[model samples]
Target: MGDKVVKFEPITHVIFDMDGLLLDTEKVYESIIKKIASKYGKEYTLEVRSELTGRTQVDSAKIAVEKMKLPITIDEYLEQYHPLCREFLQTPDLMPGAEKLVRHLAKHNIPIAIATSGNEWLSKIKTQNHVNLFSEFHHTVYGSSDPEVVNGKPAPDIYLICASRFPDNPSPDKVLVFEDAPNGVEGAYSAGMQVVMIPAPEVEEELKRHATLVLTTMEDFVPETFGLPPYDE
Candidate 1:
């Protein structure tokens, strides 16, 4: 028998996760966290990084401090870390193919939003170098500090809020989320949305199964596969 073609639901709106998916700031975060860990005589391991990825700022700080057994309060860690993050986040470049995809979506009139765990202040700093690119997003939901989002990723609150904010108020099932972290995939799935994960090279295969599609980079994303407009030559 010929193989049956798998069909995916049509996506009317799109959401993007910022740190590792849209921008190259994850490495900057890793470097900063590693430096802090070293100062405390601890190694910032990949397992710990995976745990912290896609969480709100306060949640990540709490997890990191507890996981590393660091002798400091979450507020102290943020006080020291934020300054270093602000220094490097200001100049991070867009990830590969991020601009092209975003432009294509905009040209096609797809409603798009950014749902990042980073607070508003940090989000602005991270996108300072690419203001034009960041501006293309119809709206942004800063999960860590946005008053609307009562819970962060892995809880579905942010994604739900992002979809609701769109002018058309798209249904959760009609939204497609692009993410690079397992927690984001889980959150999107919980929100009844399809998620495409473009994980880092070091991310484990086991953690990628939650996504509707898993790719190595945005360059590999085929919009047509998810019922979105295809890129024109």
Candidate 2:
């Protein structure tokens, strides 16, 4: 069969996924997961890592414990992983072009929000070093701990909630989502929003097919193509 042609529609509001999308923290996550997995003599492969991406912390911990056959409880895993994660997450660098794009959108009066699987506490820790960047968002919805978000990525709850929180409460179709995981793409798509995926180099091509647009990095994103204001050159 021929590849499906993806169409771009004008977007009025934007939603961003955190972690790998905005912060260069995916490597820290992979490193920590691998370190923990090694203790149980299990390899933390990219495939398994992909499955855990975009999930809640408890969900991810359960999956890793079960999939890796670790001799540890979910609580135990959290106890070990949380401290290690906090150490590195407190100072994550902004992903390439993330700050520029965010500030550009903010400057243009484009409504922007964040929808992340990371709970409130973890999200705060991760963004501690980049308060100015995050403060540009209209609002942020932390799916893992938000009472309003019943499900994490791969479910439309978080995205829907994010859109509803916007001042205009734009329809899902008018909201454009930026994501870095296949699950995040699926969630945004399921929410009836156009999603631009900036996937890790290690992510499989098949997983990227679901996105309305896919790019190597946020730097490559063209706001004009999506009916947003062009960046000042």
Candidate 3:
């Protein structure tokens, strides 16, 4: 036998991690983070961003304040950051291939839901302009705001919660997760779900090792590879 044939285990449902994955809101955070860092004579670097990515809002604030030595309490940091987030994040652009893929999945009746580290309020602001697209989701779990989610990404709570809310709670192995952050990938992986990561260019290769698959962008995703319905061209 030349090569052993590996059978594909088709995923029955899908969960999406938002922020840098679905909405192009990471840049908004970057701009604000850099502004505050510069004010404190601190430079917000890629390493710091890597740690904050996929974390809950409170965890992100704590990490930023500590890592950058911002000389501000986490509450104070949020005081300055939240208003700016509300302002700049209102009209966020969709990440490449976001709309097309989501729409295609919804059109094909595939069960899809969003699991985001952001709270419900910020989510509403970010998707204010894309109501039609977001409406297609079976449901959305807000890690920071949902009391049911005791922990955020990297803990598997959010993804598990998202899956449970689906009409028929899909098993871990039957849920395919799409993420753009290492923490989110870890969360999905720890939940025993197959994950496809589309990480930032700055993310190191080692950090991507846990993903079931990795792609440069959502545009590169071929749904049929995971048994998702292929788009009708």
Candidate 4:
């Protein structure tokens, strides 16, 4: 709010959203959903896929079925999607700057965490498959299927829970959140943290009101680029 630029030195921690932010896995899921919908004679449009961007699988399923007026039920959607996520995770594609950004942050010893609405299976892919990439982090918060704990994106419960886990540094002002969706940006802002919105071009307007700094991609997130300290002396 004070200065639009993020001087990262004063920031004590970084919280990342795993899907579109850290991995290029969102498109995979979108493809899977469309394929499934096609097989079942349901229409899965790009507009619908865009709407489901930052939601949990279950919630998205609900929207697809109830809100979108699809023929599938929530259980049926999960039945189709669970195995799809597992298959997708078996060979995930990392977002362009994911490796470099995490390595740089780790080298500088910045405390980091992954705050995702994804469940255990996706978390396994992110944390275990890319263990070396994020093993240095303190903890990971994979919000469960419990409705109370997870209102999903745009509601902010998940991000708030992630921030509260760092009670020693509870005030969100000390943290910087990295997000790739407007809903994620809203959630981080709702949690009271400063957020950098790195959108995927489809949802640039989603970030307009919520983002502290809106950028096209994470490729530009260098520590020194933001005037933060370099890892080496």
Best by TM-score: 2
TM-score per candidate, in order?
0.96, 0.97, 0.95, 0.86
lDDT of 4 by residue, 1-233 (tens): 44456444357778898888887787887788877777767887757766677877777788777645767779987898888877776667778877877877888777788788787666776556687786766666765454556478877787777777764655677778899877778888888887888887766463457787777778766555444566453
| lDDT per model vs. reference | 0.91, 0.91, 0.91, 0.74
Q: For all the candidates, what are their Cα RMSDs to the real structure?
A: 2.3, 1.2, 2.5, 3.1
Candidate 3 root-mean-square deviation in Å: 2.5
Per-residue alpha-carbon lDDT of candidate 2 for residues 1-233, written as tens digits (9 for 90 to 100):
16777679999999999989999999999999999999889999877899999988888998899888899999999999999888877888889999999999999999999999988988988888788888899899998899988888899899999999998899999999999999899999999999999998889888987799888899999999889999999
lDDT of 3 by residue, 23-81 (tens): 99888899999988898899999999999989999999999999999999999999998
The TM-score measured for candidate 2 stands at 0.97
Clash count, one per candidate: 0, 0, 0, 0
Worst 10 residues of 2 by lDDT: 1-10
Instruction: Please list the residue runs of candidate 1 whose C-alpha ends up more than 4 Å from where it truly belongs after superposition.
Output: 1-6
Model 4 clash pairs? Answer: none
Q: C-alpha displacement of 217 in model 1, angstroms?
A: 0.8
Q: What's the TM for model 1?
A: 0.96
lDDT of 1: 0.91
Q: Which portions of model 2 show Cα errors greater than 4 Å?
A: 1-3
